[model samples]
Target: MLAVALRHLLLLCLCVPATPPLLAESAAPPAEPLSERQRDQIDAAASYALATTLFASSDLPAALHAFERAWRWDPGEDQLLDRIVPLAVSLGRADEAIRYALIRAGDGSVSPEMLRRLALFASESEQWDEAKRLYELWLQSTPESSNAFERAMVRIELGRLYRRQGNAAEASACLAKIQKKLLAAPNSKASRQIITGLGGSLSQVYEMFGKCHLEAGELHLAAEAFSQARDELETDAAANYWLALLELERSQPLDAYAHLQQYFAAPGDPLGAAPYELLRKVLVKINDREHWPAELSRLREQHPDSLYGLQAEAETLAAAGKADDAAPLLRRLIDDALSEAAPIDEDSFAACGVWLLRHYAATGEANRVIPLVSQLGKVHPSLDPYANVIKAAISDNAFAAQVNARLRLVADQPQTNPAELLPAAYLALTAGEIDLATSIAERSLADDKNVEGDDLLSFAVGLLLADQGEAGAGLIRRALEQGAVDEESPAAWYYLSAGLRGVDDTEAVNAARRAAELAPASPEFAANVARVLQAAGQTQAAADEFAAVLRRFESDPDPSTRATLRETRLSYSYLLLQDDRVDDAVEQLQQVLDEFPSDPGASNDLSYLWSDRGLHLQRALRLAETAVAAEPDNPAYLDSRGWGLFKLGRFDEARDNLAAAVNATDEADPEILNHLAYSHLALGDRGAALRDWRRALSLIDDAQQGLLRAEIEQRLQDLARQAGVGEAPEKNPH
Candidate 1:
């Protein structure tokens, strides 16, 4: 009886109640469920109550051990993992939970739900391999239990796994399967049902699929995926960033601009650095930069060691056409990256050095480039010279010859990093050794992308140089046939660009559309596409795209967006006014003024528009006055204000302001000079008016110019005739 009592106590200590699972919100759910047996056996063993009591007492670890023992006593009590797994998770012991889940799955003690629970747990724990295995197991449990949607989701997980493993082809295939499925029957009842089952969450699935295509360099496919995702489902914040990237790469600046505005407006993590970095690049490329200095300063302050921040200072200077100023900043970055950091970023240091040398070479500062390269790159023989030959060698032949010699020597070495061969190949190409360059480039291409698109870039350079001739078409075909990609290529758009270079316009556009689905790095590329579209008479489409671009800067925290938007509105309004679209022009200018009331340019534009049409004289005068107050020395703004005063019949004041405007521009602009003549006519300064008219008339031929110019010419002649002045002086520009 005493032994039985001790046994009961042991069983009691070995039993615990079920604890809840740690959430695996992002993981897959299982389809089939097995029958679940209660703790009847544990109850019969007399330890279940004690374990439950211990669990309630918050002695979780002890209770978990008790539950395990209780299950052992009654081998039929297979639900111990269900209780123990959650308990382990609750205790912040993910590894322990994984172990329990694995044991349950291994021993056939898991129901479908329990199995899925384990998979979710593993995934949430970032035990990706283990989670992947469990997901596959879940898929294999029973074919009938899982539907096509569930299977596709599993495929997506596999695709994600493949992507994570750097297997773009496999990832692309896995994702493409879903695309095919959806495309096969997009509006079918079955498809709709599957989507409904996922709570109309197919967009998220499509987004993941798009990401796979993006990773695989299938730009067009990515674009399609993103479009479906964005249009059908919830407006995901991260997806907006990807769309912005896509628009940039497509050269659809306006579209990218709009996406960026929407992206920043989303209540996502404000500290995310990618949006700002990409935007800076986009803005610089379009020469529509806003709040540039402050934006760069923010990046530096927030992410000093980040690639974006480190590159910003130099890139911004270069963008501003200040190569001399850029050189020092890059040099400083290189020096600091080389020596000051605790774990010096050797790669960054080398890249910066390469860039600085290239800039020096480009600007004809060859005397500076060689010394810098020698100190930066040659000092570290172990470093790759991929960036070395890219810019500098192309510009400076002497430096090229010297660097080429060392690069080839490095390539001749038995075990050099593949990156070293890149510069060697480039240098060989520059030297007219096409065959050698081709061979060396192939060798380098066989290596992984050393710096972003280096491998594909090498291949491209080689392809261009090898005199592949008409074989270019065949070569592209072969590339497609062989599924050959430059090593672990992340240059996804290259797939679209290369395949559709001159093949099929429809296909090219499709491919571009897909590429735009991902996070693109080239807004210029997007702008090119937009230009092509616009030239093709897709005016409305182009307009829509540009409108999207305008939306991008609307809600930005950076003042750059406001500045950019103002300029955009300024141009848009100017065009509208030129077209006699008075209402539209006013609305556009009103938007700029409403958003940036203090903007002198916007104020001047608003005032001038009203004054030009002889409308809203009082309001125009106030706006002009405000603009004049803001930019006292700006000739254009002063002219707008003077025109406003003249429209209000303040003749003498108009003359004074118009005189300043003429003097400010050295009387260069024809339109401003025309306005000054009108002001002089209003003030009865016949000689002054005659002289200004003569200059304006000499600068413009009535027959060769627009309606406005013709109007100005007629007005000048009328004023001269009325004042009884002689015909205009010959070639009097001053």
Candidate 2:
């Protein structure tokens, strides 16, 4: 009975809470429970409480040990197993966690939260097979709890695993499942957020698909994938812009233009003027067919100061044949652009000048060219050559003369550009100073030692020498030997071949033939070769070549080339007149005058032909007067007028104009001297005529020496017979 009482005391000691101990050491030992069931219950309760504390502090190793001991004492404590499974997962023991989770999940004892945690942990550890299996178990055991968000997240994780493994098709299938679920429950905020988070991963999958297709050269499929991604994205300006660029790369300008317009209109896009400028070019191409006036007008109104808008307006007006209207707008744009103090690109400046030149030339508004020239002169000094040429076209003689004088000053300076000197030389030649022109041309060519192949400067000098009837053959040979004359160099070959023909070189004639063969499509080259062949006595070949040139280039030849061709035909007519083919020459001159009614040279030449042939002197005088008024300061036109007046018996007017032409410059022009002599002779001033004629003969070069000598001899004989003086011997022109 005492033993039984002690056992009961032990049972109480184990079951009840412990009492507070005294401070002194020496205390009696307390009895414990003797029943196994009570011992197990006490141990289980203590272990569970400690495990809870350990689990709360995230001490998974200790928590697992305590939980295992709890489970061992109370094997039916399935809740302890549930706690231990999650702790195992928290400790990165996913395999152990999943094993226990599956067993409890199968027994209908595991909570859905615990199963879900186990599956996510397995997925995080890249145990995709285990993660997938556990997720399936959870779904099967708790199908009612399998909502859209849970199912979508599980599929998204599987998709990511497949994507990592490079199984894009399988990955895409998984991602599609998430998309389908989200779409089906579009109003669910939780599902939408889940899908949105997964959107990035899905986008990457689409990008991978697009890139693979692109690498395989399947552009259409690649474009389709890119389109899918673009549609899925909420805010991706770069992606949209890249799609437009891809369209552009495929030469789908219309599609590209549409996409780019949309991109530019989108909010918060950072692509700047690049897209707008490209769109302008595309619009210009489409504008050829589409009447986009309102669209262009809107762009101008909304973005009045945008460079692209200005360019579009300028192009539209120019295309519509409203150059007069376009000129002011272009000027305003230039001013506005300059006022912005933005750094001017070279292209912008060049575009401004090019637009103005096109408009002014097209409308025949030569006066409008002056302001552009002046503006270009002030802003871009490197463009002085083009500016001076435009300035010289001004109707105001004083303004034109001022421009020529300024260019002369620039050309005379020691540090002046050698490239600019050639034009200045031509200006001097036109001003009737052959000696100064020759000097300038020679000096310019000498200074330009480093001139590149086929440049304008080298070609200009070669043409200048040839036009002057000087030793240009050597320059032509030098240019060709330097490889400056090739298929790409039409202008170079044209000028060099013309120069060689001037010197009667057989080698040059063959080289000219080669140039024609190289660029048969070049009208200027063909025309130049024809002129040379005619000069070299190959009339039939020259005629055939000219016919071919006219046939090919009649539609859209360069204006300058057209002018040169007209002048060449006029020259050929003059040659025919010299050959005593008077009717044919007259017909040719008539055709030229009919074709180019505004050509001053053709008018002057035709009038001179009429005067020389003694046909309709009054008409010749009228045409020559008109020519002189058109080009008031031109010495050639002035000479033509003076000759025409002399032919019409207006000797006094002729004398006055001829004297003005003679004193226009220091170096005498042979043609001007001849005109003055003829005027003096017609006015019964034989002595003055002889003096002028002798002066004219002295001014001519060796090429014209024979003609001058014959004229002088005839005049001398006529004077001797008229004045009762002995016949004077022939005097050498040299």
Candidate 3:
């Protein structure tokens, strides 16, 4: 028996024969058939050995030739075809491999191993139908074979073939069979090898199954399949990741988050970083609901190395208003990212810095934003507008001066951005340098002519020009013609009105009226329009306009606008008092004080009205003192306080406050100086009083000039008569 076995094995090896005598040029004899004994001796071993030797010798083309010869000689020897198929593939001979693979594919003599080799070759050559047909034949023929391992592998390949052919139902049937086979197989090396060899990746199978189910629109089934396959996978990362993705597609974020948490928990899991990122997004979507903090905290604790963890923690802190805590964490992240030897990505760093800066500003801790700004300057110096704006806003005088010097250096460079001129205009305006402001504003406007309708810098320049008098009228006309003006623009109209009022033009008053009509809701516009009406010598119209302004802006939330409305109404009321409408004037002033109790201007004006009427002397004194306390540096408020005290017969106190007001003035304001002169005269200091009244006369405009000149002339004559110097040449009051 041993001798027969050895002879049969030897003949099996020789049955393939040598290279067919190199296809000799001379006529060759026909090939002889193998005897029945020799054919019976042919087994898997001899075929495998011959194929291995030819393949190992690096004679791939000859090896495939030998494998084919061996397969043809013993047609039942499916093992030889198996050896031939891969060898043909290794030699890039797809056509030859397909020929041998088809012959043994459905033969019971063909082993599961041979079917796998054939399927692989067919798949590599993109012979999807042939590969599927071969795998299906092997699967059907070996349904009960002990080669469950090979059977499982063939099923997986079959599944892949069907998947590629877009036959989802057939593909799912093949994969489902393989999954059942794998579940039934014993947990041994062979079974494990089969599991591993099914494309050598369990995740791939699940991914395939997932795709099959998804394309069929069986999402729940897909999720369940993916979930089961993922559980079988030792790594579980990919499985968990796919499962999470499936849940996300279903809009079940909470379930997705749960899967992501598990994925993040596995150490060295391939999907650790990716799952943590998905978890963060999921958490953010439902963060406004309950239990968000727990989810965010879990992510932070579990995946400290993940950037998404740090981002989640930062977002959590910011949402809770704990910006102080978020800043240090963000700084550490930035430092670690930048310290790496690799080049930093500017876009990523800028996005992080922008978030941090916005949070810092929100918390009102502008000083804490310097580090982020400094880092941004290093990485993206060219596009650092927000950084520059923040730096300019947070710094005081000394720091502002230093920043300005540095900005000047940057601006002087030839490659400086023209957009930098906008901030330069703002800095100049804030520094009270009008010429520099004008130059920067003009440059900014020229560079960026698409300036928005309500640009604040343009409005500031127009207002500054208007405050300087008639020299600003041409500038206002140019601004109006530049298409920068809009009907609803309050500042434009204010400037237009002031320019017209300076030249005493009624056309400007009409334009102001149009502006008021456009922005009737704006308190500032109404107040300016009332002032214009008063300037146009329409007192009754002015009073009615002031009343309209107070009513319109009664619900306004802005403190500054509210203060202006109160002050304007009080001034109109005082005008009424001058016109001997005492009852109406007192009612308006009382209403002003009642409406804006914290406004020092309203309080002082009301007090002045009261004292001028001589009805509420004690109450007026208290109100005036309160006004001075609120705005001690305001000379107008101080003068009102002093006048109130003078009316109350506290002449000494009145003199001290009035003198302080007078000395505080850089340019002599006629009304303030006149009040000081009146207080001094009431205190019996005639010389000092005379000196102040004369100074007041020199500072008045044409309207106030007439009144001041008359007062000073009368005071000078009284002083001359008291000193016995005779009336000093009666100077014309007009």
TM-score for all predictions? 0.36, 0.35, 0.38
Candidate-wise lDDT, in order: 0.61, 0.62, 0.63
TM-score of 3: 0.38
Error of 3 at 571 (Å): 4.1
lDDT of 2 by residue, 451-470 (tens): 44434335345346436533
Which window of 10 residues has the lowest lDDT sum in candidate 3?
A: 725-734
lDDT computed for candidate 2: 0.62
Query: What's the count of clashing pairs in each model shown?
Result: 27, 2, 0
Candidate 3 — which residues are off by over 4 angstroms? 1-511, 532-541, 551-564, 574-580, 667-703, 719-734
Which residue pairs of candidate 3 clash?
A: none
lDDT of 3: 0.63
lDDT of 1 by residue, 1-734 (tens): 22343465566677543543355445446535322122234232455556678999987755765665455334455565578667765665555555556655555444555456667767775778777767766766747446776676667677777778788878888788778778689887657766776567877777777878877778788888888887874557667777777777777777876777676555533325567777777777678677667766864665556543556677777878987887887776666555654223455566666677666556655445434543553334322464445543555577665555555554566575554555555445545555555555445434334422434343453444455422232333343334444322334443444444454545555444445444343333343343334444455554455466565434332334444555666765655665677898787776665444456787788889888777666767878888989889899998998888887778788878888887887546677777778777666566787788678777775665566577666676665575477543322111
Report the lDDT tens digits of candidate 3 across residue range 484-508: 5454566666666776784775866
- RMSD of candidates 1 onward, in order: 32.3, 45.0, 43.0
Ranking by lDDT: 3, 2, 1
| Model 3 steric clash total | 0
